[model samples]
Target: MIATVVSSYPKIPNRPSPARLRNAINRFDRGAITEEEIRRIEDEVTEEALQQQAEAGLDLVTDGQIRWEDEQTYLARQLNGISLNGLTRWFDTNMYYRQPVIEGAITWQKPITVDDYRFAVEHSEKPVKAVLTGPYTLARLSVDQHYGSVGALAKAYAGALNREAKALQEAGATLIQFNEPAILQHKREFEQFAGLCRSLVDGITVETSLYLYFGDAEGIYPQILDLPFQLIGLDFVMGAKNEALLQSAPFTKKLGLGIIDARNTKLESVDEIAERIRSLAAGLASDQIHVSPSAGLEFLPREVAQEKLRRLAQGVRQAEAVLV
Candidate 1:
């Protein structure tokens, strides 16, 4: 079994915080700080985030999305015909995301995250997985003035995502993940959601995965298993019923078991986590399981997040040892 993060990792200690970064951006915008200084800060933060993932003994690493303002706005602003509109509470979290405004036909004019993905690949010792927000989530979070309906908007965004995924694949990314947390909110559109995701990955050759978090997936179980993804990630921490759902469904693809809680500050017991992994492995097989936090580790403090990563890696290792 391998360990990896779904997306953003918490900022490291004593480093320039997100608030500081935003302030720097504000200064740069107002011509108080030079563009070169902002780039230098971004590079430094990304390098540290990569180093922390590698140090955690993770098999797959990400840039920790340190450069992103939030999940939606960063990528939304990068695409053509889309702009950052206003703030909205992201799900039930205290954090806010800049709601995307669709002013015209959405198109992928240029690579948004390819440069960042390449930077992570260049800095990290381990293999890096390129992460992107899924089309459904992007469409759902956006204020669609151009596209008539949510389905139409999602499909348009799917094409853009497909183009981006292929670009990342050509840039030497073997693993690509599309995070669709919004799917849990719209369970009635399971078939349409699956079709949109299929269109997003249509002809991409790289290994692909889907990560759903922040909500229970009990209602959409079995149906989601039918999606064409090499791996499927589920939040077992937030959705305790997922264990039974997995038993009831026939899951053949790789399973990214989110056993660690990322939102809470309380630490998880390595032994208990390992035991749960052992139980899941009894039916799913240890080789098909990949362990990670239930969601991004950005909510917790730096030290606590680091400890969680260590515990996650240790717990997975211990579980695999028991299976061996």
Candidate 2:
């Protein structure tokens, strides 16, 4: 079994702290700091995140998205016809992301996340997974002034995402993941969203995954299982309905079992996590299961996040032993 994070790791411990980085970004915008200095800070943080994941012994790792301002705004800013308008609360978190304003037709101007993925690959011994915000989530989160409707915006976003996914694949990314936390709110448009996800990965040869969190997935479980993704991640911690959903639905794809709660500060025992995985493993192949925090580790403190990762790795090992 593989142990990994869904997306986003905590920021580097110190030296180029969040405050310092924010100041650097502000300085760069005001022409007080050079672009090279900003790049240096980003590289330092990215390397620290990668090293932390490596030290924790994860089977698959992510770039930790250190350079990202927020999940959607960073990628949205790279596309044409979208502007960062103002601050908006991100989901239920204390943090905020600049709201993406869709002013006109959306088009991919350049590779958004490929360079970061490549950087992580070069710095780490572990294989890196290229992570992107899904088309559905991007469309749902952005203010749609030009697209007229969510469906049209999603379609446009999918095409742009396809270009980015292909770029990551070419950059030696064997695994690609699209984060669509907004899908939980748009359950009625399941079919349309599924098709959009398919469009995003049309010609990509690498393994693809769709990670849904922050809400219940039980209502759309059976339908979501049919999506073209090779893996489906469900937040069992937040979505208590997922337990019944998993039991009732036919889960043919690999399961990213979210047993650790990323939002909560209290540490979960490795034995408890292992038991949850063991129970889920009874219904699926041992190799088909992957363990992760219920969502991104960004909600926790840096030291807490690192300990959670260690527990995740230990829990997977214990669960796999039972399965064997």
Candidate 3:
């Protein structure tokens, strides 16, 4: 399906807008402010960001992760297996995640799709992807509460989340992406995680995509080639070397080439990024490629992020011109 989508692809630039920032602010202010205030802000900011993506010429637009607290905790809230804990130090980066602590056996909190799909349909004309953190990644990031192996915990989480994905599909979502940045940490287990993820949404109408970021994807390249997902997101900012991995791996999966560095504030030039995309697309056909930022766009200031996305989207156009 990604191959078909890319075949006669329009000249579109994809970028993250101010939506994630507004969501972050709302996450922090949730208990402090009224629930009505949260909904109003989410609607207002999401509307503006969706318009900005369309105006910026983004081909495929996301909610910029506006509805998430962080990636993992968002799923935690939706699934009954865990509870959200306050921030904890991330390994090396200045980043800290709102951790999810497993409190009991896994279960769906309720039907998890209504609000996300409703918002996407209401806001954007372009295809909107419903994003969730993969269950295995969530379990890996969390400390086990008497569960023997992390894999067991991950599989349990996967079942509940896949149901959520199914619900999203029924509610009019056309694409559903599960973000699994932690999969890079467990190379030996990557394929199993991917398989488990695949099982969750197998027959669902939504086109499924899996995203990995924040680490070199070299070790997991071969493992990913056989997965059944329609699209795979790679973090070029951190995994540029994985560009070579793409050349070696023989698969027809759509590449979500994350060309923009999302964690930094300094805007990258269109020329530099265009050059990289040209080199990266050397063997890959135009139909095999899709472009995005390294990860979510909340790392930079709202203005910086906007500039970065604009340049990234423009860079793709410049690269396509060069290729043609």
Candidate 4:
């Protein structure tokens, strides 16, 4: 229903010498620093990023995700009935995530996104989106101890996520996004997972969005048409190039077209990104598109991340101007 700018997730890659991120991490890990201190660091980073968005002319902004351990781990830690183990290697380099080992039926220890929403509401002038890892993706990535089928586990996870969603909405979150990168890995499971999420939030007034990254939308086109979300975010940089998926799927949900590459360190040019948007607009209605990065900015250097986001906002403005 609205045009906006979104981040897949932004990170504060280790800062420069003397003013290092390690200083912040060390204090927190050692219990010498307070949560307020960590928040202060996040606030400072968020302020700079938001300013960049405003200058580059964007409608929506994220907190840059300086407060999270990882995109999925934030909510994974809040869920009950699971033991979170330290991240293991899923790919090359240090890429990792909190592995939720199912010990029993999953439920939340408390409201997962309330503090995140509260921080954004109090600190940010632009509308804030509360993000969550989708149930299907979570189940697929983690090991299930009790639930035999991934489908059954996904339903349980979705129910728990719905509770979190309700709490986030009540907390004044303007938008909620379910980040589902694993959707590209398996189509059938992703469809089932997306359906359960829709069922849980049925009739709810919240503006729910499903965010997919790292792969194409081809596999999930059949299910996306019927999903209850008001918006859908995709990683256009890494997603399949064919336009058939976009043409076939109903564009009822606004498209969060990720035009910027988040994993790469090289900054994208405004003109270059605008080209991607131009392509997307060929099939998607103008009003249906929102510009965004492809994945978490944590994968890129902090300076590179900031520059890419700023460029993305600029690209959006340029595209909007031409479209108008």
Candidate 5:
């Protein structure tokens, strides 16, 4: 069994203390510091994020996305022909992201997250996973003036993202996960989304996962199993509809159970998590599962996020003990 994060980790400074990273950003905006200085601060926070996950006994780690802005903007600001505009509320949450505006053809001009992922692999004792905000979510969140339709824009984004995914695969990453929470809301677009997903996942030998969070996926349960990803991550933390899948038959592919809440600061019940995994014993083998939060920990305080990691690692261990 493995303990992993679905996508991001928190970088918020602890309360009552000034954060060097935030301060650096302020200075950077004022032209008081260089981009390298800003990156140095990001590196510190990324190392801290990876170190805490290791200390909590997690087998898989991410860069905590310290160097980037929000998940949506991180890729949009980089890809060709897309510009970032005003902040908009993300999904039903209070959180906001710089809305990506599609003004022209979207293309991947260069490497996006390779340097950060490489740094994570070098610093952590455990294997590192590279995460990308999937094309469907990006298309839904964007202001589409050029593509005329979300499906067309998503397909273009997928073509670009496929190149980026190949870059990560060649960079020695152990896992590459695409976050596609938009599917939970736009369930009617499953066919369009599925075709794009199949093309994006083609030819990647390393482990790949489609991480869906922020809502339930009951509408497309068994049908989603046909997609090509080696693993499917479900958001049991967000909706009861997802947890209901535990009563279904065994999963053919590997699974990721996002039972731990990332939005709430309260630490989870270890016993409850153990039971959740136990419930999945019928549907999945213990080794075929990855335990994680419903989404990124960027919604919580830094300390709370680390504690959640500890809490999750503990729960996974307990589940393993009883499952044996």
Candidate 6:
């Protein structure tokens, strides 16, 4: 079993030292910092995030999405035919993300994250997993003013992301993930969303993941077991019912069992985390399991998130030792 983060890690800096990234963004907002200066600060924090993951002894790492303003707008800003307007509350979280307003046909103008992924791969000791906002989630969250039909809007987003996925693969990303928390929330739309995801990853050769969080996936249980992607990340922390569902229908497909709680500040004991991993692994091959946090750690302070990753890695090792 491996310890990996779901999508993002806390990008906030620990206290005592100044929050350069936060300060830089505030400076930029006031037209004080240059675009180049803001990017430089982003790079510095991205490196710090990657270094924290490496120090925690994770087998895989993400860029921590330090450059992303939010889950949706980062990718949307790169695509044509969309303009971001007004902040909207993101699901139940207190955080707000800029809403994308579609005005014309969506098209992928250039590589959205290839350069960013390459930078992470270059700096990190571990293999970096590239992440993209899933098309279904993007379509669901965004307001369509031009495309009238949801199907057309989803397909257009899917088409654009499909190209982006291929570009990441060609540029040497072994693993890429699509964040689709919207899927579990709108369970009735699973069939259509799954079909859209399947079409998005049709010919991409590299391994891919459809990461679902924010709620339980009980409604799509065994069907998720049959997904074409190489891995599926589900939130077992908030989606606790999924534990019972998985036990009722076990499979050998790689499952990212979210055992560590990223939402809380207190650290989960390594023994407790190991027990959850052990209980979850009893239903499948131990090698097919990857322990992760409930969701992104963006809400937590950086110090807490770093310790969580360390505990996660320790828990995996303990579980593996017992299994062996």
lDDT of 5 at 191: 89
Question: How much is the lDDT of residue 16 in candidate 1?
Answer: 53
- Per-model clash counts, in order, read 0, 0, 2, 0, 0, 0
Model 6 C-alpha lDDT per residue in residues 1-324, reported as the tens digit of each score: 778988787777768878988899999999998999999989999999899999997888999999998999999999999999899999988899999999999999899899999999999999899999999889989999988877678889999999999999999999988888988888887788777988899789888887888888888888886777888888888888988887778655788887787788989988998998998878567778778898888978888898898989999999999997
Each model's lDDT comes to 0.88, 0.88, 0.71, 0.71, 0.87, 0.88
Q: List the residue pairs that clash in candidate 3.
A: 13-58, 13-59
**Candidate 4 local lDDT, 1-324, one digit each (tens):** 133444434444443524434577788889989988977876676666566555555667666666667656677777888887777754233688777788898886689768766876677667667777778878877788989888888888888888888888888777888877776777766547657877667545878888888878786675675678888788777875525577775566688887677778878888997877876776566777777877766677666766776778778777777776
Candidate 2: where are CA atoms >4 Å away? 14-23, 26-30
In candidate 5, what are the lDDT values of residues 201-308, reduced to their tens digit?
777888889999988877788778888898889888786686666566457788888889889988888888888888865546789999999899888888888888
- Please, what is the TM-score per model? 0.95, 0.95, 0.86, 0.88, 0.97, 0.97
In terms of lDDT, the poorest run of 10 residues in model 1 is 11-20
Count of backbone collisions in candidate 5:
0
- Candidate 1 ranges with C-alpha deviation above 4 Å: 12-23, 26-30
Q: How do the residues 104-183 of candidate 3 rate in per-residue lDDT, one tens digit apiece?
A: 88888677656856786688876667777777778888877846788888888888887888888788788778877787
Decoy 5 TM-score against native: 0.97
Candidate 1 residue lDDT tens string, 1-324: 888888998655644545556567789999999989998878878888888887877878899999888899888888998988878999888899999999999999888899999999998898889999999999999999999999999999999999999999889889999999999988999889989988999989889999999877877887777898999999998888888887887788899888889899899988988998888767677778889999998888877888888888888889889887
Model 4 lDDT, full chain set: 0.71
Model 6: residue 109 alpha-carbon error in angstroms: 0.8
lDDT of 6 at 32: 99
Model 6 ranges off by over 4 Å: none
